[model samples]
Target: MTPDLADGGAASAAPSPAAAERAARAPLMSVRNVTKVFGRDVVALRGMSLDVRQGDFISLLGPSGCGKSTALRLIAGLSNPTSGRIEWAGGGRTDADLGVVFQEPTLMPWATVAKNVWLPMRLRGKSFASCRADIEDALETVGLKGFEGAYPRELSGGMKMRVSIARAMVTRPKMILMDEPFAALDEITRFKLNNDLLAMRAKLNCTVIFVTHSVFESVFLSDRIVVMAARPGRVIHELNVDEPYPRAEIFRTSAEYAAQCRAASEALNEAMGGAGAGHE
Candidate 1:
């Protein structure tokens, strides 16, 4: 699953055995020399490549102009690369095998929570009645069991995000693409949602490709951080957390987390100096 090779990644130290082992596995999907340009002059991403193995939790970390969201969109098939390819191991697949969660809840305000979660399944030709149990379980999984009948307008921001995540999970997609899903929430709420996300990931046993600008959040939630640079955004470094799952508040305050964050911060600092400016 080793995603970044540019700059040989920014780790001052060696990866843990666990992380190395993980990197050696077969990739579920691979992006080779991907590039996306907004127009004639604006280059969003350039020659970006990465490998995503099954059950991996990867975070694309960088500054605002870095191609993190663009990368996610490519992975979700919501957009296409200017000149590159994304290949899945088992050959071609349908949209049903993928899920996406945007920064905003983006729920249908007119629909109830249950109905919102049922949208994906419905789009695939299943009726609400047919997937009622799956919908209920998805809601409960996100800690919104009793709010099924509630409308988006009636729910809090965190609850609305829960609905969004539930909808993504309901499809049991092999991989979920999340674009700063908790970025707008307050710190306390964001922390809770982070924990909830890890727990739900464990229960669902699905891969996640998350886009975020938060170093601490990425360290706590991701096993691998694909560091990117702007000005024709591209991978600059890749750091592996190597910590086992079920990360908790204790882990948050641990020395390991702080060290990883510092390393990532340093790599990010150098990239912000425009490391990608002269590169294609």
Candidate 2:
């Protein structure tokens, strides 16, 4: 359940020292001048750059051809950038350090939910029996406690997506990349998942880079929204929601949310017009 925030922010008068310290620290990851070009004439992304700090919920909000997924794939190391680089504050990246959830649930049809969630660990030579407790805990966290033995076909679209999220989170990576994980669900389900996702992030303190086509979803879920342009896709503007997390339905209906939506909408319009890509 979402906790009621009295003022919609500031559970207390003064910010905690931990909060201040987190704010002061450097970004956890930096994408510097990254551009992705597919064969001869296709350019999926160009000169894209952004910083991802720990505990951030950033949404890459853009249109059809804006390369949002391409950016995510690049960050996940599924594809290499044509130019520029992605740098981690600590060191180089390894498969174990990142988690990725695509728009599709992408669970194995023949496998049980627990088996699917255990795949990552199993790939690292950990036996399914050995990871049973971790798998059950992840399923419980995602509200799928007793459905472990169920298969994907037995679950609803939303439930399947929850299983997908559980699989991504079971490893407890420092960062998670979601490429429209909730886009296929119905509005009611999406809203429910949105709330659950924030709650999960709060519990895990994981950095999230989300890609979304909906301005409302972006504004509702993100601490920062990066608006992108097409025609060799790139970022044109970035807007900070600057709102506190664990935000409830009340925040969705608040005047502040409305204003933020308007700003994001306007930015989207400009991006579609091919506004010059902006810089930090």
Q: Please name the candidate that would achieve the greatest lDDT relative to the true structure.
A: 1
Candidate 1, residue 139: lDDT: 91
TM-score of each: 0.92, 0.89
Q: Return the lDDT, model 1, position 232.
A: 74
User: Candidate 2, residue 202: CA error in Å?
Assistant: 0.5
lDDT of 2 by residue, 1-280 (tens): 1122221232223555534654675678999999999997799999999988877888999988899999999899889999999999889887777888889999999999999999999999999889999999999999999998999999999999999999999999989999999989999999999999988888988999999999999999987789898887999877777557679989999887987787787778777762433421
Top-TM-score candidate index: 1
Model 1 CA deviation exceeding 4 Å by range: 1-17, 274-280
For model 1, residues 1-280, the per-residue Cα lDDT tens digits are 2334332344325666766767676778999999999979799999998999988999999988889999988888888889999899899658888888999999999999999999999998998899999999999999999998999999999999999999999999989999999999999999999999999999998989999999999999998889998887998887778778878889899888887887777777766764444433
User: Worst lDDT window (10 residues) for model 1?
Assistant: 1-10
